[model samples]
Target: MADSITTIGFDADDTLWQNEQFFRSSERQFAAMLAPYFDGDDLMDRLLAVEKRNLQYYGFGIKGFTLSLVETAIEVTEGNIPASVIADILAAGREMLWHPVETLPHVTETLEGLADRYRLVLITKGDLFDQERKLAQSGLGDFFDAIEIVSDKDRSTYERIFTQHGDGPRHAVMVGNSLKSDVVPAIEAGSWGVFVPHELTWVLEHVDEPVSSSRFRRIETLRALPEVLAEISAAYSAA
Candidate 1:
């Protein structure tokens, strides 16, 4: 229950500010750029495959994605991708890196309300520089007790975060859009996992929905979170 929990970790990107939507838009643009030589859907699918394969080498971020886009274009076009097309791909990456960090509806306000009463930490996974840049520009950095931009989210990662915060798993909760990245691992690591679904999740992040567990919950939106926590805490206190 919420009352028993002392530390809360939030995933950045879609959970706090706009992220995947930009990537989705960029993918469409990339596909359109290559529409002459390759079918758009096929091109996008190839690009996704390249991204998946390159994830280990490039990790996650705009730079790697831009590189993958270029690589995909070259491969699809048999090394005939024009310089102009390459330039456009690079420009898209720049636009993404420079895009305004728009905090989602009620995200900052929710953090504000919760920060006053509980320890809040940001536990996001991405390129270090890009993640830090977004956090600096987000204007909500002051609300967090700690910030952890990890390479990935797994059970060990969540366990370490809990240990670092001195809360352990029983006293911590993780909230985010990706069930795979945020909820399941946190729950497996002995913490509460709250799934806040987003409309435009990447297909790669999808998994079967998690069944309800003692420390797992699914909520429609962050707007209902405060009340949810209150109810959980009340139940905890009763127990």
Candidate 2:
């Protein structure tokens, strides 16, 4: 038997770099800004609701999130939200967009270690411009053989990407923080799904773990990736 995995796909936000923390920070600011308008209302929940409803219209990323914040503010205030407040909200969004990328611990070294051994791909879902900006600033762009900044992640998307970039999902491994977007679908696509949990993952992205799948593996961090891959290879070779 040959090696079970030949290609590796990585998720950008949270997995490779700091992402949801910024959103969390902005959300607290949004809630504080809206607090004076209405007392005891869960503004964060309202914002998340708007975000879910508007995902079709705006997709993901700071721009969409900013629009949702403004919409939530107006709705909560019954169209009485101040223009200055709205300006402040927009400014917050701009600040998030301009925020510098900070790669997670072990990301750079792990990517460098794996780059020589596997066909590496960056597969992430979000606003194209924002994703590209993060990737460019990450200084890890050259490590990947291909970069996929998709609108969403699904089994079909994984199948298409892995097949096109490598030998297909059977020979691929997708590592990321989201169980919904990164792990489950990649497993459904017949690839190994490596889950590396991130503390600040978005609530909407949460899903039950696919623990029963033989192709599924969970690691504490990206630093353990090579060891896990070796284990997978040995297990496959034995069978």
Candidate that would win on TM-score: 2
Candidate 1: list runs displaced more than 4 Å. 1-3
Which pairs, if any, clash in model 1?
A: none
Q: What's the TM-score of every candidate structure?
A: 0.95, 0.98
Q: Cα deviation in Å at residue 217, candidate 2? A: 0.8
Q: What are the per-residue Cα lDDT tens digits for candidate 1 across 47-157?
A: 889999999999888999999999999999999889999999999999998898988888878998999787899999888989999999999899999999888899999
lDDT of 2: 0.93
Which runs in model 2 stand beyond 4 Å of their true positions? 1-3
Residue 64, candidate 1: Cα error in Å is 1.3
